[model samples]
Target: MAEVEIVVAHRERATLRVGEVFLKVDADRARADAEVEAMALAPVPTPRVLWRAPPVLALAALPGTALDSTASPAAWAAAGAAARALHDAPPPPWPGPSPEEIAARLDRECAWFAADDVLPADLLTRNRRLADTALRPWTPVFTHGDLQASHVFADGDAITGVLDWSEAAPGDALSDLATLTLGREERLADVLAGYDADVDTGLIHAWWSLRCLLVVRWLVEHGFDPRPEIAVLEARR
Candidate 1:
């Protein structure tokens, strides 16, 4: 029998890896549906779907390890190339958050942070001002939506595949760039080099600030320290 390992679990979802198969169980069926559809639509390498049942999805494990801990600039470039391929594909049928929606979320989350005193008021203010740059109109592209390092798999300088399509949708390409380079700002140039189009540096920086600020509180609530993200935010100031 294949050994079953608990990958991750939370109130909303859980993942179990049984040898070469990964089983994802999501409480929200819509998210599971999106994952299935997004994997089918994406042009880049995605984990092969083996089977699915409501609230659960089974995927064949990709060969490489997660890219989060890799320090190679070449690997970063490969990840960027994969991102470019995905963006170059036809847009998913579903929509992503519009600029206005993102701005609104920032506003709401900032208010919560202020009420909770999560960070120094001045730090939050500075970051919020910087975030304004990312709030403008953008040409939408197919986006990974959650392009965390853990979701990308690389073998040496080559990208094997990207995982977790649950948040996949149409959104600003910079969002994916920013997400991939989060806390690892030094690799931004390498990633951009592999990208298909000219990137707006200001928007990427703004998204970084916005993203870090928005997620800090959530990280803390989940018993994860937000210090690293906070350090990233402060460094930008």
Candidate 2:
């Protein structure tokens, strides 16, 4: 029998690994379509599409370990290089959520947190101070909308491949930088050096706070603890 592993399983989607092939079952077909298209457009290496059907995408796995906060600075630099390549590539046909939309969502989420007493009002208010920095306008590039550390794959100092492109679209490049470097400030310099662009540290920090704040409620609802992200936000103050 082939080795089968459940990579992820949740209400929105599930990914199963059978031997070297990965089967991603998504609740939304549009997301699946975006993944397929993004993979084709990405300048960096990505999982090969074995096939695709509505709600499921089959891909050949690439060899590497998942990128994480604990990885060495060299690895983070490599990830940055890969990201630079992705951003340098032409934008996808579809655009990501606009700043206005994201800001509105943030407003709603903050309200929800306050209304539900999810956290001390002061903490939320403190983080919201830098929130506007993140919502500022920026040039849109090809971005991996959900560029989590876990989504990047690396071998030693080289980036082997990136996974999970369902949210890939034309969006802010700093958002990706902020996502990868979240809670790992030590790697920020190396990553920025490899990115080969002028990046605003303040905005990156702002995005970091904004990203964590926006996801906390969703993470809680998904049965995942938001403590780690919360800690990062708290540390910013």
Candidate 3:
């Protein structure tokens, strides 16, 4: 058989054109893709899952660039609206990992830190405190666990599609907003305004700070230099 032609290569996955089929593959990508396809709802154009083989899933090729590279404010608004629409979609009866399971995973990651690093400790504590206070009263909404621009695609002022549903879960919507914002505060403001979101900006900022700290600590533990960008973001706090 002739080898498939590679179209795009992303971090741990690749998009390939295999004869008449477009294949998107990475371990565990199928589960999320399957879930998204099975859930009946609005007109969101999630990739059509053709086949599943554990870590490898094949999806129809979506045509567009990742929203991260798109500069149009209208495109950003469309992305925000798409996220809101996905959140409003009724979820399937799939059993997601529980809070205890997530905490255990975090605990495993936290174990990588040594006494010299205080950021992880502070992050864990802050997450707990926020869970009790701010997040407690908020209604849980379906969240794109890793709602970053890299996972979205846009065409001019319209969102062409969204990708990477692996981290899809039920959580506070503001967390997703914070993740999307990351280092783009102005864009974040624009997105919030465009979406007419009622989330507390202060809390989102707090979470953004904590999330950055978590990244810094992870880099430190992995023997990477936590300099420059991390230092700058930390200085802003």
Top lDDT prediction, candidate number:
2
Q: Model 1: per-residue lDDT, tens digit, 164-234?
A: 98889889888899999998888899889888578888889999998987788778777678898888888
Tens-digit lDDT string for candidate 3 (2-37): 578986565555667776566666655556464454
Q: For residues 30-53, what per-residue lDDT tens digits would candidate 2 score against the true structure?
A: 888888989988999999999888
Output candidate 3 Cα RMSD. 4.9
Pairs in steric clash, model 3 = 27-55
lDDT of each: 0.87, 0.88, 0.61
lDDT value, candidate 1, whole model: 0.87
Residue 224's C-alpha lDDT in candidate 2? 84
Off by over 4 Å in 1: 69-71
Error of 2 at 15 (Å): 0.8
Candidate 2 Cα lDDT to native: 0.88
Worst-scoring 10-residue span by lDDT in model 1: 64-73
Please report, as a residue range, the 10-residue window in candidate 2 with the lowest summed lDDT. 64-73
Q: What value does the lDDT take at residue 198 in candidate 2? A: 83
Q: Please give the clash total of every predicted structure, in order.
A: 0, 0, 1
Q: What shift in Å separates residue 81 of candidate 3 from its native position after superposition?
A: 1.2
What TM-score number comes out for model 1? 0.94
